[model samples]
Target: MSSTTNYILGVFDDEDEVLHAVSEVKSKGIKIDEVYTPFPIHGLDTAIGHERTRLPIAAFMFGTLGMICALSLISYTMVFDWPMIIGGKDFFALPNWIPVTFEGTVLFTAFGLVITFCISNNLFPGNNVEPLDLRITDDKFVMAINLDKNKLGQDEITKALKSSGAIEVNVK
Candidate 1:
């Protein structure tokens, strides 16, 4: 079985116009699905009412786990299993363990964040890619509104887009 989702796309030539349109559309009670731009626009996320991401928290957790694993391995090998005594240093010297610990923390955080981002965005291998508007990756700013999520009719939404400086409004 296949399912098709309908969307109303408001294409803007400028980032400022799209930013203003986000507020205008929301004021009229039309929920915006997402906004796409050629580059990042400051305050766009806030304007679109998206909450702050929790990726930093995830990174911290991953780093901590990595540090623990690194420390555990070093402690087990040097202090318990082998009991190494090199350069007159203690078997479990903190100074010597810094490099490995730092590397482990960085490695886990990098890999964890990449996996998290890919999974969150449904960007697995072989997943079909859908672009609402090709210009969104070049020069245009696009505001996408999922028709099923909005109570407003297409005509009303189109009017709202025009009043907010959209150059073209398309439905797909």
Candidate 2:
């Protein structure tokens, strides 16, 4: 779904093998497209040289937006629209709004991250992706390579992946 094509992907069985292979291959000047594992493995990003994620930035922006919206709504409702006094609290005191403001900020930030992640990855329910292998989501680890450069043929890439400690290497 990501327009990745002509890439050579090497799958691994053991997480350590993937980690060691990543570090070694990268040192040998070979580029990796992506790595996938059934569970999070430590230092996977570092070994693969992946850039830091942007989800936190998205969450912060959405949280700020939510805080602004909540503050504005509270101001309009308590001060301008209804001008209500609750338990002798001042009409515009921000302390009175801390609970709702905090709640809204967290809620919007979480939802924003989810939406951004889904949109950015193009992963949503009903957006069917051709599964590489069912086992990949269960017990196996997978690596997706983008081979648009057309530099290595099947045999050469296969040999490279096999030598890198891939338990099974096959083109799909």
On the 0 to 100 scale, the lDDT of residue 80 in model 1 is 96
Q: Mind giving the per-residue lDDT tens digits that candidate 1 earns over 97-149?
A: 99999999999999999999999888899998869888889999999999888
How many clashing pairs in candidate 1? Answer: 0
Instruction: Report lDDT (Cα) of residue 167, candidate 1.
Output: 95
What residue pairs are clashing in model 2?
A: 6-147, 7-146, 7-147
- The parts of candidate 2 lying over 4 Å away from their true place are 1-4
Question: Lowest lDDT 10-mer window, candidate 2?
Answer: 144-153
Tens-place lDDT digits, model 2, residues 69-128: 898898999999999778988889888799999998998998999899999998898998
lDDT of 2: 0.78
Clashing pairs in 1: none
Those runs of model 1 whose alpha carbons end farther than 4 Å from true positions after fitting are 1-3
